[model samples]
Target: MAAVPLQEWERGDKTNVEIIGYGWRVLEYFHAEEKRVMVRLHLPADRDKDRIQLAVMLMLRDIKHSRKWLCEFCGAPARETHTFNFFYRVLDSDLPRLVVYCHFVCDMDKRHVREGLTATHHLMNTRFDGTLGPMPPFASFGKRPSGKVYPLAGSCAGCQHEDTAVDEGVLKRCARCKMTRVCGAACQRADWGRHKVACGMIYSVTFENWG
Candidate 1:
């Protein structure tokens, strides 16, 4: 579904905006100060609908706490909860905003640690009262690899060869994406034609200001 513009929402007519077949309903609408408009969306009980809701929430400038529990990192249902404090830079403001993560362990799993910033943890005294049991182990959210057994290396993007630590500088990451690993300059040069598009897309979205 296409995203509705702010002008359409400001029209103050519920029928002016179309969301009939989009599996979402407008529960409430309010105009706040500072030219901010609040629209409460009621999403259906579907996975895709939930994802749409999450995307909408992320675009909002000022978000308040809700009763729905979601993992800040993975967007899954939160079982064990903790609070994390981090500064998030937005387009509207020069100063970064202090944001709190409901699931602090998920934040750690993403490896978002900066050079000088250290994250302080505060455990929330909340427990899941639903029928669901303890949270399952996620592949992306787990203890850090020792690098002794796994070595924390990726396969060569060009040759598709499994990177092994034969020397200290065996595999070097691509300067742009930093995700693709190349065995040597020759492999990187060979892969440039095919890898450039994907690399640019990933790097722009992840690192650069493409918002």
Candidate 2:
């Protein structure tokens, strides 16, 4: 299994510490380093906690390699699977930022329930409070029953349209930020004045050019 960075453990981010705490006892068997805090895994006796430890290790190993959608709790790969994608309200004015985690392990532990519709449904519909109630009638996972998904595509910073280079080949991604997509040269030129500041910030972070 991969090893987590000591720096990350030292940082003591609440979420990070919670995940590490989950499997810390099992992890200690593999690494002999002393730690400031430790918590035992609460899996059934037959179920090994090594898998959880490995998942956490892999997550820390890849944190700086570009993919940021990995499980926020256990560090498992989250994107192409049955992930629980929701938001925790962090700011008063801003829309909730997306948090994704593997449905089977991370979400189950947080809800303190075994695998079932009760856990999955709660993850999709409700907020992050630790409550286990019946699944609401209107709750549906993936694209909804109406076959519509919100934020259909990346909005063009130039035209403010729900289209992007991935969905529309005509659009080209911004050369600097690589986040903004524009319909054409005309749109890119029109948006340049307003986008420059954000573009510089994004470029600096992406390339690790900050000094």
Candidate 3:
């Protein structure tokens, strides 16, 4: 389990987190010092930006990473909150819907659960609010609210994969040009090498989005 930085926990910005393992769709950020857990979700690629942002805001209000289940109160997407009795189970239910996900954990004791779904219910009961009713054996924080986790936006157009290189964990450079592949590195490299110097200058142009 990799340790999360202080700033990331204090300030939520996954620009420095490394999510190599734990499934392609899942993400986990660990806080060793305080034993805190941050939950994140995988947003669909084809979703509209406005809808995605709305889902994210809803997740924040309910402390959920994504909108896996619909709320009983309102037709709006449901999220996990400290007020629920079976919070952990509800949280786990949200994962399969999202393609990518992850969270921070302490030990194997809490790791073991029925299909990894019950853990969310347990965490909610214990951490969100102090209600010893039907509690599971674990560490602490059955009454405290867990940290917020958000879906990471943006990807490298170069590889077409969702993985990011900002954390310095995996330095993926352009395979053809041997330069950092931020976007379309392979295509740019091929064109630059064979197209001559004059041709290369043609692509050195930039355009504004709103202008």
Candidate 4:
């Protein structure tokens, strides 16, 4: 069911009474000026193996810097319910518009954290609500605009390795070549001596060509 806004949450106006359909469920809460919409989606309740595929889909739909959002709900214990949060622009749309989103699982178990990270990685590349597709160029809405690389949220070959920017000023610099990189450290170390003399040249073994 799609989310619906209510004057008060206790009134149960957005409560759903039917079995989940189309791998989705939705709920809503509203106050005087804004609304919140929450959607719980699963690949198929019948099994757990489909989560990876579900994650890929979720990741591919995450867009950078636009108004899309995630909804979150908090709970206790490791096995409790997963919650998400989404914001809405009540005055801007015909009824409400979901704008922000977050995911809340009960605890920080490795599996759950991995899922969360995967979803976040996906968000970096995708931004639509329900499908995997190309994202549109984003326009700034706030006073101080962001000046960072806002990549589309989707699967990239780079997600498997450790983040190059990990911990206390440990720059991902090639020792031999003295060049900076966003790719992981292993690639940098491998090309050190060879890259030193070839630095910044086409034949240089930069991280991009380490493979």
Task: Report per-prediction Cα RMSD to one decimal.
Answer: 17.2, 16.3, 18.6, 20.7
All candidates' lDDT scores?
A: 0.32, 0.35, 0.29, 0.28
- Best-performing candidate as measured by lDDT: 2
Tens-place lDDT per residue, model 4, 1-211, is 4555533211232211111101111343342221122222222222232432333233222211111111222212112112222222222333322222333233333354446535653574465353423322122212223443322111111331323323323434334323333245555456444343333221121111111
Residue 87 alpha-carbon offset, candidate 2, angstroms? 11
lDDT of residue 204 for candidate 3: 16
lDDT of 4 at 188: 49
- Please give the RMSD of candidate 1 to the true structure: 17.2
Considering summed lDDT, which 10 consecutive residues are worst modelled in model 2? Answer: 17-26
Error of 4 at 47 (Å): 36
The digit string of per-residue lDDT tens for model 2 on 106-163 reads 2333333334435555664566464334654322533333543322123455665433
Error of 4 at 102 (Å): 8.9
| Candidate 1 deviant stretches above 4 angstroms | 1-153, 163-169, 204-211
Cα-based lDDT at residue 12, candidate 2: 24
Model 4 spans with C-alpha error above 4 angstroms: 1-78, 97-106, 111-114, 117-125, 129-211
Quick one: ranking by TM-score, best first?
Answer: 2, 1, 3, 4
Q: Which candidate is the best by TM-score?
A: 2
Clash counts for all predictions: 0, 0, 16, 27
Worst 10 residues of 1 by lDDT: 15-24
